[model samples]
Each structure stands twice: as C-alpha cells, then as structure tokens.
Target: MDIDVFATAHRLEWQRLDALIRRRRRLTGPEVDELVELYQRAATHLSTVRSSGQDPALTARLSGLVARGRSAVTGAHASAWGDVSGFFVRTFPAVLYRMRWWWIGSALLSLALGAGIAVWIMADPQVQAAIGPPEEIRAYVEHDFANYYVEHPGASFAAQVWTNNAWVSALALVLGVFGCLPTVYVLAQNAANLGVAGGLMFAHGKGDIFLGLIIPHGLLELTAVFVAAGVGIKLGWTLIAPGPRPRLQALAEEARAAMAVVLGLVVVLFVSGLIEGFVTGWVHITWLRIAIGVAAEALFLAYVFVLGRKAVHEGETGDIAHRPETAPVAG
Candidate 1:
C-alpha cells in the first residue's frame, strides 16, 4: 500500500470528522446523526490502517481521531460518582487481589524480621547495653513510649500520623520505579523500629502495655505499609524483566497499577491513624481495642479477596478502559 496515496484518499473524511467532533455540542439532530456515521467510518478506517501495517504514525493519528469521535458521539464524559464507584468495586479490589501474594509475602517477612530482632535484642545483654542504660530503657518501656501517643491532642495526632504514614507509603511507591532497593530499605527500617520497640517493652516487663497499644492500630497500619512496599518492589521488577511485553509497556502498566494501590492505601492508612490516635491511647479495655484492629484488618482482607477476586475473574486489570494509548505523531 502506498502510504501517500492511502493518506491522501482518506484525509478529507478525517478532517471532516475532526471538525464535527470539535463542534459536536452545537450540532443539530441531523448533524448529530452525521457525526455518528462519520465516527463509525473513521473507526473502520483506523482498523484498516492498523491491520495494513502502514506507517505507525498514520495509525496513531487515526486512532486518536476515532477515539475523540467516539467520545463525542457516545457522550464519554461519565459522571465522577460512577468512576469512583467503579474504582472501589472493580479497580481497587482487582489490583489488590491480583497482587495479593506480593503483599502477603512482604507482610510475613517484615513481621518475622521484626519479631526476630525483638527476640535478639531481648536475649543479648550487650545489645541492651548498646541501646541505652537499663534505667533509660525501662523509662521508655513504661512511660515515654505510651506517652508519645497522648502527648498531642487526638485530632492533631491523627493528622500527624496520617501524613507521616502516607509519605512513607508514597516514597516506597514512587521510588520503586528505580528498582526494589529503596522500598526494601524502607521496609527494613520500619521492621527494625518495630522490633526495637517491642523488644524494649518486653525486656522491661511492659509487653502487655506495648501489645495493647500497638495491636489496636498496628495490624492495619503495618499491613498498608507492607502492601505499598510490595507493589513498589513489583514495579521495579517489571523494569528489570518485563517478560513478553515491551519493557516500557510493562512498566507503564505496572506503574499505573501501583498508583491505584497507592491511592487506595491512603484511605487505609487514614483509618489506622484514627485508631492509633483515638483507640490505642484513649481506650481502657485492652481486648476491645485489639478486637477493633482485628476487625479493621479483617474487613480489608475481605474487600481484597471477595471483591478483588470477582473483579479479576470478570477481567478487571485495575486500569482505565482499554484503548490505543499510542501518542500521535506528525503525519
């Protein structure tokens, strides 16, 4: 097929379609009918160009023109509420379920590392000495640790925790494009901190206090972090080995998926922050607080497994509606 001849033959029709799409709002009933017919014709033209293996540039421009035409004819500007509803019901859960193993592994590894570090700290006298004098350690275990939460007003404290956790999750996600190194470092640091805190509390015979406070919020809070980190690592791996797809294409898809996880985790972290600020410190009953955390965690897991699995089976990829995304090139 002669590229010049093909483009010249269809150029007028394409230009007419473009003009009608631009002025679609003011089109009369008959003109609207014309627009729909032109849109369908342009779509067929695009399919022909794609199948012919003509210039990639020609295919891309026709693709865009057809997309715009379709939008204008079909009223593609959907309501915002509909988009939000679709995200939770399909996008969020599908992404969560699709990547479940990645996050679950992260959660197990981090928790194991944290618990191991705590045990090591407790058993090693030298490690205890290295941390601080016994008296300072005891003071932290009994007073300063718990006091940290109550020092600020609940509302302010919740905001502070939410912002901090959100930032951490964002970093893990954004930096993950480079490779998994940054995310791994972030997760390791977090796990180590948890271990140190728990180990110190147990060493001073305040394990009950530590568990009571941490369990109420830490369950959900830490899970969100692990999820973020896991997704980030997965994004980095996509760059390293994109499998059968082109590397850039693979990275773009994974990056989009990771972003959805990032947005969803913000709400999850906020809930955990609320529990930390209000329930962890304020609630007197230990078992009740832990139960609340457990319940929150349970709901999250259910959302992923139930909604996510169903969405995945229904072909959700946690991405926007599929269309040709190739950028237009000058003809």
Candidate 2:
C-alpha cells in the first residue's frame, strides 16, 4: 500500500471515469460499461487508500469520483415535494406525538408559575410597586396593555411576532446541549413575564380584557414555546440518562427529533402569530376570537395525536434514515 505508487497506478483510471461521468449522457454502450467498471474499481481503491491511511489528497479525489459515479449510476433522487410530503406526514407529527407528555408538562408548569406570580402581584401592593411606578402601572392597565397590540399594522406585527418567537425557540434548541439550566431559565423568564402582565391587568380590574386579548393567540403560541423548551430540556436530560442506547446514539436520535420539532413549530408559531396580529386586536369579538383560538389549538393537538401516533406506529422516528452525502464518512 505505497501511497505514491497507488496514486500513480490508479490516476489514469480515475481521470477516465471522471471524463465518462461528465459525458455520461452521450456514452456509447461499451463506454458506459467501461465507466461502470472503472467506478467499481475506484470504489475499492478508495476503501483501500482510506484503510491504509495513505495520501489524504488521493483519498479526497477518489471520494469525489465515487460520489459523482453514484449519482451517474443511481440517477437523481426523489423530488423536493416528496421530501416535504414525507416530513409533514411522518417526521413532524411523529415528533410532536412522541414527545407530547414532555411539552404538555412543560406548558402546565409554566402556566402555573405565571399564574402564581400574577396572584402574588395582585395580593401584594409592594410587589406591584417593585415592578414599576404607580402612574406607569395605571397607564399600562388602563391604556398601554390593550394598545400595544394595535399600535402596529397587523401584517407587520405578525411578521415581527413570527421572527421573535422563532428566534426564541431556535435558541432554546441550539443551547439545549449545555444542560437544562439555560432551557429552564428561558421557560421561567417567559412564565414570569406573563405573570407580571396578568397580575397588572387583573389588579386593575381589566382581567376580562386581558383574557379576551391574550387567550386568542396565547393558547397556540404558548404551546409552541412549551414544546421547544420541553424538547430542549429533554436534550439536556439525554446526557444524564441516555436509556438503553449509547449516549451518542441517544443524543443523535433526540437531536434529529428536536430538529423536526423546530421546523414544525415554525409553522405552528406562524399560525399563532396570524391570530395574534389579525384576530386579537382587530376582531373585537370576545367569544368569536376565543373560539378561533380554541379551534387552532384543537387542530394542532389533533394533528399531533392522530397523525403523529399513526406515523410512530408505522415506525417513523422522525429521523431521515437514508442519507446520500454520508458516503463512507457520511451519517
């Protein structure tokens, strides 16, 4: 396995195969046969060069040649639409369903914290004063709270909400590997903010208005955030308890599923943003707005429970099993 000798011996065959691949469309029957032969031989060469720890440059060259040869042999893969279809039908929903308890628990816990904070703030004048000046609080409860939603144009507001929520969710996922503390901090901060706002509104006797405005969009929006935090926390937990699988394998599986959740939440959050921007401020009908929110939340839950369950039953783990780029060094 002399590195220089191997490279010199197979260099011509590699070049010939490259040329044939570039012009594969116009190759005669014999040339196509020769191309296939050369490709097979080069694949073996690649394996040998790699195993022997020979010249890295020669290995890279062979790797590229084999990849191109695979494309030529296998033709193109399935269309983009196929991938998208599989994602929604299997990957996204399966992930949501599989991790339902984690996210649901997260939502319940966060809601409790937020509600506790609100009650504490309402019960204690000192808490209210600690938050801000009385005049500012009065202004917020009387005017600012309701006006915040309507201050911007609906479309612009929706876009802003989408961007902000997506960033928060993405950040949670990205930082998940650091352990669960950061994820818990994110969840706590979100809950505390909600608590403060609700406490202020309730204390001022604008509780009904708060419910009318926040419930319409908050149901779905908060659920999406909870899913992100739950999945993130689960990622951190995977480090502590990888279960039966090896730690790296367990982490990889969770990571793949987390990615699917991230993509799925983008769509979920977008819908919630639309409700917040368009329906919450401008609709002005209490029952109707709340009904719309309930409907959206129900649909999302159904999607996860029904479709996701089915996909999981069919053995979809939300990870793409086949990856072409993962050749020998792939996966």
Number of the top-ranking candidate, with TM-score as the measure: 1
lDDT tens string, model 1, 53-122? 7577888788889888878987987689998898888998899899888889888999999999999988
> Tens-digit lDDT track for model 2 on 203-313?
989999999999899999999999998899889999878999878778877998898998889899999999999999999889999999999999988989999999999
What is candidate 2's CA lDDT for residue 19? 95
lDDT (Cα atoms) of all candidates against the true structure: 0.88, 0.88
Show where candidate 1 strays beyond 4 Å. Answer: 325-331
C-alpha lDDT of residue 121 in model 1? 89
Q: State the lDDT at 312 in candidate 2.
A: 95
Which ranges of candidate 2 are over 4 A from the true structure?
A: 1-76, 324-331
Q: Could you give the C-alpha RMSD of every candidate to the true structure, in order shown?
A: 2.2, 4.2
For each candidate, what TM-score against the reference? Answer: 0.93, 0.81
Judged by lDDT against the true structure, how good is candidate 1?
0.88
State residue 44's C-alpha deviation in candidate 1, in Å: 1.5
